[model samples]
Target: MTLVPYAGSSAPASASVAELRPRPKSYVSRIWRHGPNDGVPLFRIDAAIDPATIEDRALSAALAPFAAQLQDLSIYVLHAEEVKPLAPWAVGRLDVDEKSAHVFLHDYLAAPNGMLMLNLFQAPGAVADIVMGVAPMVVEPRRIHFAITDYDIGIRASIG
Candidate 1:
């Protein structure tokens, strides 16, 4: 699925606000089921809140024990937006319908600052860091459509 970034103001408050409520009883929810092979136990971790909202000191403190305990696993303290599918399908959809693409750009550029996806992932810290890093990086939405059409048929065909 394409990662639909929630702009800071538009994002759900709970995802961005930490002091707004009491410390949640838990962050990690582990689910276990039988695996397809060998009947081995399969596990997945479902965290309730985004880690970027937590204060740095608190995050370090919480991670300390886990860091000590989990020696084998790589402790990749990455931002929530760090790993997501590229939104090539969005460009493809725009190419197929030029009028809709123009309308989309008109609507996006009507704002003081046009929105562009950050092409790279970031490390953990204040969630505002993500916004600040992307603020100066701007691209014309129409060019995005052109790049997809001119460069790659794979991208154009991926959507429709």
Candidate 2:
């Protein structure tokens, strides 16, 4: 799954915003399961947006329409993860193809900057069982409640 920041404005007169703006790169920084019954796989994705490349002026202008919402804008990290199968009877298999499913940033102007609309899109020809198995993790979290630290011992220790 690909995660991209939503450009607040519509298409430009000369060229599309996507064509002009460089796409931000994202990676799965961490993944873990929560609770029991095979648990829900939560993936923490870290994305880097270079302020130098992204035209803040253009973004600001586009966001001017929603001035009230942007009053106290705060930076936020977004992520996507795997969910359990929807079918009650479909059991035994627990493996999920993380590549086929993704939750992408859809809109940022509807409400406060903190309020995000994440949309889940699955790749074509992907297995239904796998997709169903991994659908909820991306769609469940209303807000991520986790602490961010300068250093990550969990990942480092595991890798070592």
Clashing pairs in 1: none
lDDT of each: 0.21, 0.24
Worst 10 residues of 1 by lDDT: 129-138
Best by TM-score: 2
Candidate 2: residue 22 lDDT (0-100) = 17
Clashing pairs in 2: none
**Estimated TM-score per prediction?**
0.17, 0.23
Expressed as tens digits, the lDDT of each residue in 55-127 for candidate 1 is 5444323323333222222111122232231232211111112122110111221223321211111213212
RMSD values for the candidates in order, in angstroms, are: 20.8, 18.0
